[model samples]
Target: MTLTPQDRTIVEATQAGLPLVTRPFAVVAESLGLSEAELIDRLKQLKAQGVIRRIGAAPNHYRLGMTANGMTVWDVDDAVVDSLGEKVGALPFVTHCYRRPRALPDWPYNLFAMVHGETREEVIAKRVEISSLLGKACRAGDILFSTRILKKTGMRLRGKEG
Candidate 1:
């Protein structure tokens, strides 16, 4: 999408992430020489125009004492996968969940949900809870624990080189 010069400036100013201060928008707006209200309005407009998907915090799960992270994969019956996925995603321990296309032959899991806890055993217990919820709809499943942390960040706008 084509962003206006001003919108581009706003995106560039905040893409690295908003300030960790109490008044983050205000800080960004000040840096852009715009009022906080104007910055917020423009952001809302950008979202409406599909230029921005969402603005949210990406917390560090490990820092929050949730060191054990497991991505549970399930071979769910396609007929009810979507409906069942919604239920699995809503679980308290599930940090994120979605459906993926099955690889077949080698990999047949079509549903994935991430669970986090203080330990691997805790994560496994949460996986059991998910399995119970899936019941007969889930045929096979497995859990992959995270070995290392990865940096996460939002989209960034590149500046024009004159």
Candidate 2:
């Protein structure tokens, strides 16, 4: 999508992340010489136009004492996967969940959910809860534990050449 010069400036200014302050938007607006209200309005417009999906905090799960992270994959019946996915996504222990296309013979999982806890055992326990919820609809499943942390970042705008 083509962003206006002003919107481009806003994206460039805040893409790294909003300022770490009580009033982050106000700080960003001040830096860009725009009022806080104007910045918020533009952001809302961008979201409505599908230029941005969402604006929210990306917390460090490890720092929050959730060191054990596992991505649980399930081979759920395609007929009910979407509905079951909604239920899995709503569960308190599931940080994120969604449905994916199966790779057939070798890999059959179609439902994916990320669970976090302080230990592998805890994560496995949470996985059991998910299995219980899936019931007979889920045929096979597995958990892939995270070995290291990776930086999570959003899209960034390139600087204009002078």
Candidate 3:
């Protein structure tokens, strides 16, 4: 999709992530020299045109005392993966869930879900819950606990101000 220069400014300003305060869009809009309504309207247009998927926040779970983070991968039945993924994704502990293509001869996982908890045991319990939810649909599953912190950055768009 083609984005106007103003849309590029919007994307660039938001790429750094919104401020942690009430009326974040208002602050951003003012910085971009645009009204809040104009910014909202342009964002709606951008979304309608599929330029952006959705706007949301990525909280730092570590700061929230969620130290144990596990990415669980499953070899689920192809026919039931979507339904199972939706169910797993809806769970409160799961931060992210999606289906992925499996690599042959080595990797066989088709579904992935990330769960965060205050402790390792809690993460494991969440894994059990997911296994129970999948039942026999899950051929196999494994949990990979995060051992190190990686920088988390969202999408970035190139623009004049960027």
Candidate 4:
């Protein structure tokens, strides 16, 4: 991606958080030898170009009292999976919901939902609730708890793709 003068400053400064002060942008601008407006403008440009997907925090759910986090997969009917996937994704307890192509030979689950709770029982209860919501459509399924989290972070600006 082309890095215009302003693009370079916003990319570098925001690679770090929006500085942690009252005049954060001013501080970032100073460091880059540019004005606050210029820095802000660059961020706007980057967003418009779709070079920056989002500016937000990536919190570790497990560390934040969400001890029981599981990747629950379902063997759903192909005809209804697309619709059910959207419905399940709308639930509050389900943080991440997506469709993965069914695996061959050893695997068949195609729908995946991430469920999190404070304890194992709570997680199981939520799963049952989710299962009930699916109303027997989730013929077979499994949950794989998160044992450890390797890393969590926002976008990477030093590289082209993150």
Per-candidate clashes, comma-separated = 0, 0, 0, 0
Over 4 Å off, model 3 = 20-23, 48-50, 160-162
Candidate 4 lDDT, 41-146, residue by residue in tens? 8778788988887676656676798988898888898888989999889999998899999877678899999999999888888888778877767778888888
Candidates' TM-scores? 0.86, 0.86, 0.88, 0.75
Preferred candidate (TM-score higher): 1 or 4: 1
Write down the RMSD of all candidates, one decimal each: 2.2, 2.2, 2.3, 3.5
- Candidate 3 on 1-162: residue-level lDDT in tens? 677778888988887778888999999999999998998999998888898878887778899999999999999999999998999999988989999999985889999999999999999999999999999999899999999987677667765644
Tens digits of per-residue lDDT for model 1, 21-132: 9999999999899999999999999999988878998778889999999999999999999999999999888878999998869999999999999999999999999999
Candidate achieving the largest TM-score: 3
The per-model lDDT (C-alpha) reads 0.92, 0.92, 0.91, 0.82
Model 2 residue pairs with clashes: none
Question: How do the residues 1-162 of candidate 2 rate in per-residue lDDT, one tens digit apiece?
Answer: 799999999888877888788999999999999999999999999989998878888887888999999999999998999999999999999988988899878899999999999999999999999999999999999999999867566567898889
Q: After superposition, how far is residue 158 of candidate 2 from its true place, in Å?
A: 4.5
lDDT of 4 at 63: 72
Q: Rank the candidates by TM-score, best first.
A: 3, 2, 1, 4
